[model samples]
Target: MQHEHWWPRPYRFDALLAPGVARARDCAGGIIVVKQGGVPAPLLRLRHPHLAAVVAADCHHHVLAWAGGVPMARLAGRVPVAAAVRWTGQLLAALACLHDAGVVHRDVTAANAMVVGTDAVLIDYGLAAPPGSCAVAGTPASTAPEGWRGHADARSDLFAVGVLLYRLLTGRHPFPGPPFAALQRILHGPVAAPSTQAPQCGSAFDPLLARALAARPSDRFASAAAMAAALDAAQAAFKLHCAANGGLARVAGECRKNGNRNDKYRERERKYRV
Candidate 1:
């Protein structure tokens, strides 16, 4: 096999028959499984609540313990604004941890985030690189404008988070169309505010997304922690508005609808909670 050399002693290839295996394969980082071994030394060193755990690894590949949950992609348009805000905060926290470790997650798309219980976890580190790597990698729809010009850093990752938040709020990409067209829109076209696409999201998201998806790195949040703090404030304000206007019922209704649509995920969530 082409990957026969990827696994070293004591860690043999397992029969890749888990749900997480499929998801890992589908992810950009492409983490896989290797049977019966401790997590590799290098992979085990970095630890964070929101980062997926690695099971084993070698120079060419990493075997991550399956992070079982629904992909954020599946929750599009169904997530309540409060839930979306919370999840985005969790992802930003994850990014902060990665950034602090001197690593930049070049790929930060909806498909790369998994919702486990009430929390969000960031998976797949295949494209991760040190700061200022300028690799020109990541999914086009979520890539920052500077990314197309072969630059990627913490701010570039934040841009992708903005894209994910837009999808979660409005159930669509900000720059929707064919790949090239979307890339062009990201580069030069204007993005409508999330409230414009889905009024329920409110206007607070407008300025936040504007800053997050800014054309220039210097114009975006200074750090992931800073962005997360802003999101927390937005979430708090949203809660107050809902409580005063009786919007809590609407939020609950949306959660119920989403639960009905994803019964399996609810079951998985129950298992995790147990």
Candidate 2:
């Protein structure tokens, strides 16, 4: 007699996407990922354009609809300000939707964010929970100060966004060191302005980052939508300042043109399902 299996039927394992995660192809040849963990209760029905879709779930493992792309971790410290602004906006929108559903991602790190063509998709809901859930879970470097205290909320995710944006802009973590050292710095050390390391960022991002990375959650943007709007305004101001100084304006313009071309290319790729 054939033995029983752990994962559900109608799905065959194709390849290992990572440790504890495997890519599984459905009967119709659609790609999905089976992750070795329980789906957080709060996110069982959560869905958003920028978030990876959950297809099925059980206590032992959960499957997510797959999107082909590169992880943001691989592109860390190399993303241009123009691209960073766009991608960050996408992430914020995802967070806003999650927050509206009364869920907090808890862990929003570079590895969890993917760049699919010209769009950004937030993936991996393994650490997601409702706001005010007391648990310390997430990548050490990206965890907020409040996270260290066993408290997590929407604003805590915003702190991680600040760290991610800082890395994209400056090409380095705001607090760099071993995991423990980084935690100490996050809890007590001061973060430098992004422009100090990346002159291209200019002063426009200084205040915005300060507010996002603030040690106190109350001092940060009230919500993800608010932070997204601030990022848009800051990018516009930075472009204007660059134009006045005759510095990065040309580069920004070139990036925008290239972005448009990329969007068209992505649309074609989607049409062909490439």
Q: Choose the strongest candidate by lDDT.
A: 2
User: Model 1: which ten-residue window has the lowest total lDDT?
Assistant: 34-43
Any idea how many clashes model 1 has? 0
Model 1 C-alpha lDDT per residue in residues 98-152, reported as the tens digit of each score:
8887777788998889987788888877677677776677788888888778778
lDDT of 2: 0.78
Clashes of 2: 0
Could you report the Cα RMSD, in angstroms, for every candidate shown? 6.2, 6.1
Q: lDDT of each model, Cα atoms only?
A: 0.72, 0.78
Model 1 alpha-carbon drift over 4 Å, by segment:
1-10, 15-44, 251-274
